[model samples]
Target: MEITFKANKNINQEQLLKLYNDVEWYAYTNDMPQLQQALLQSLDVISAWDQEVLVGLIRVVGDGLTIVYVQDILVLNAYQNRGIASQLMEQMMTKYTHVRQKVLLTEEAPDVRHFYEKNDFESCDKGSLVAFAKFG
Candidate 1:
């Protein structure tokens, strides 16, 4: 039940990529190029493991000193509701609070919204600022 934070450059990309696919929040089913880009953008990431088994992960994409968007905060299905995500967010906050531009996007579901709130996020009103995405 130990959480370990490591820079993406220091870890095995293949294992970390596998963890990314294992998350439920992964929307694209077959987009290797995009996935690689996503991995490259993550300045800070962590893998939660019980010994050698990877159970959860958190990734942040942005310039480490400024805008960090927390993405793919996930824990295995069996590991849900156990404060694992909370702990991951807590770790991120502790490490990057001074960045002053921390943000995360959640799916359009009540449960997802609740999860974000519990981790100290609130709904923002960005009038006329549309958020866009593409799935391949």
Candidate 2:
């Protein structure tokens, strides 16, 4: 399958909403686009399309000259294990290699950790490094 990659700021909102809904790790109740308007405005987003169908996407939220946090790296359920997410992450990391750090927060799961480790992430030591999270 041919995959087209681009930094498409004006991605189809409907497709994105559907894709977000399909994510296995999170549930949503509010309007995604409204919630994501700030992110869409500030983040560097890359999308993968195969023959006009969006297959995967990745977003980097950062200061552009400093640390970058990887967010919303999602691939459709039907497209899992196809290396699309890896390619997207490689692209994202390459884009921010000059930054102080490229970071991501994963759920507490071995498989998720393995996935991030494959992409060059290490488990953050809470004793040495303080981490923060915002929960509702």
Candidate 3:
């Protein structure tokens, strides 16, 4: 499949919902309006498309100079293992090459950890730093 990537593209609610639901991300799919608004307000968003279908996406939120937080990176189930996520990440990294800190928090899964590590992101515990978060 010839996948195309777009930055800060105009995405409708139906497209977002379908992509999120394809990956079983119920939390986002459960609140369509909030998810749509969040994407709209994010600092940057890179999306992968197969023709007109939204197959993958990566979203970042931060000041763009000192730090950038990778808030989300996901590809549809069928689209996984095909380098779509990596391409999306590469675009984000290339866009913020000058940023000192690029951070992301994700579930403690082996594949997830491997993906980030392969993309040159070291875990907080592996370095001389630590991370903390409190979800409401």
Candidate 4:
């Protein structure tokens, strides 16, 4: 499968909803307008497409200099295990190599941890850093 990557915020609501829903991310799919607005205002967005089908996406939000927070990285269930997410991460990392800090929060899972670790991200617990988050 030839997957093409694009760095742009021109994705339609249907594509966003389908991609998120495929990954069971109902939290984002629940509010279409909010999600769309969030992506539109993101620092950067990289998407993978199989021809015309949206298969994967990775988006970050930050000031683009001191810090960058990877707000979301997801791939369609059928498209997992194919290195699409890794490619997205590689592109994002390359784009922000000058940034001092790169941060992301994800569910606590062994596979998830492995994926991030493979991508060169260290867990806060393993280092001298600590992370805190409060959800509204």
Best by TM-score: 4
Inter-residue clash pairs, candidate 2: none
Off by over 4 Å in 4: none
Worst 10 residues of 1 by lDDT: 3-12
Candidate 2 lDDT over residue span 75-125, tens digit each: 887888889999999998888888887778767864787788899887786
Best by lDDT: 4
lDDT of 3 by residue, 7-59 (tens): 86469889898889887889998999899889989999999999998999999
Order the candidates by TM-score, highest first: 4, 3, 2, 1
lDDT of 4: 0.96
* lDDT, model 2: 0.78
User: Could you tell me which residue pairs clash in candidate 1?
Assistant: none
- Give one digit per residue, the lDDT tens place, for model 4 in 21-61: 99899999999999999999999999999999999999999
Off by over 4 Å in 2: 24-29
- How far is each candidate from the true structure, as Cα RMSD in Å? 3.6, 2.2, 1.0, 0.7
Worst 10 residues of 3 by lDDT: 6-15
TM-score of 2: 0.86
